[model samples]
Target: MTEIPLEHVHVAPDEESGGEPAPAVFVLHGRGADEEDLLPVAAELPDELHVVSLRAPDPLQGGYTWYELDLSAGGLESSQPDADDFRRSLDLIGESVERAVDAYGLDADRLGLLGFSQGAITSLSLLLEDPDRYAWVVALHGYLAESHADLDPDGIEGKPVFVGAGAGDRVIPESRTTAAVERFETLDADVASGSFPGGHGIGPQELDAVVEFVASRTA
Candidate 1:
């Protein structure tokens, strides 16, 4: 894979005096959102963990986007025109993940990825493409992109994954979420799936569950 540079901002624990190597969590925001959008969620997590939010390479109208979208279908279209671009974008993310792990002195086996919307799709793709890269993955209000069925489940065996979506999410239908959950299960991932009452947005209950899962895995 080609090397991809990342622009990141770190959030350290409030109590840490200095120079402590805390476990790190990489946060990826949804389409048209920047790294700073999800930084606040880090506060909801355990204070001991470090949070790093990454910005996507491609800049959209105002913010950033993972890949091109097919708004008509509410899904990603993988044609020749967009296929290679998407793959390369994912590769960039993978490289960024490796960099974060090394830069933060995080345990390779304890690294985590948390994403929302398009960011969630990218997160799941990375885990599926390179299984065992993250100890835990939280995909909020996102679906597995095209060609996920062809992934080798053995790669992610025993990895913990939390998938949360709103029951009325229009951007990502519940059926897509169901398919993603089933696919992760088939891949032998320790998957937990839940739905909230709102639409295409994160709620407190969902965030709490994700925080607990990350703490349990890293602790």
Candidate 2:
């Protein structure tokens, strides 16, 4: 667990208010994006969600990256995260979720993770490392971390997981996307995956599907 509280977290309050505790969706932005990047998508989600977006630890070219990447040999590969950085990120995200739950008075049973690209990679890493920590996971245009090999998908048994991929995603090839889906399935994650007709980014149709999936989980 993270000893220090997560700093630079961006928050968007629940759209609806009652006395009851609401669900929370922690958003993770893609590489070169800031904490506020995914707030729009979060707003489009269920109004009951307390949307919280986190800034990644590593600083890059005027933006932030959860970990370093290397595209040297033909495809994407993780370069910065060794075993330690990987564990630190998982702990940081886990503790951040806990903090958000306590601070927002959010529903622990309904906590979810949403991310794009590098953010999606982190979301998957965090979820796989501590499967019981999150209720649902949504990964868009992202892959499993190359350095992360220890997986216990049984921990996430019966949990809903959505993965969105672009058919023509040049940045992350189709093979990687297939591998991600396979890995999740191997762990027995309730996987819902879709391939859109675009590249490296979420389209309207994909977003609509994600909204429906998340709504079902949050409902």
In the order shown, the candidates' Cα RMSDs to the true structure are 3.4, 2.9
lDDT of every predicted structure (CA atoms): 0.78, 0.79
TM-score, one value per model: 0.88, 0.88
Q: Which residue runs does candidate 2 get wrong by more than 4 Å? A: 1-4, 9-17, 70-82
Clashes of each: 0, 0
Off by over 4 Å in 1: 1-4, 15-21, 70-81
Q: Estimate, for each residue in 1-219, the C-alpha lDDT of model 1 and write its tens digit.
A: 323276767786665736645667788998888989898787787777778888887899799877776445434422211565678778777888787666666556667889998878888988888776777889998888775656885568888999998988887777777888998988888999898888888888888888888778766
Q: Model 2 has how many clashing residue pairs? A: 0
In the range 1-219, model 2's lDDT, one tens digit per residue, is 233365555454546656677878888888888888777788788877788888888788888877665545444533334456556767877887787777777788778999998888888888877778789999998888766645775577767899989999887765676788888887788999999989988889999999999998988
What lDDT score goes with residue 171 in model 1?
72
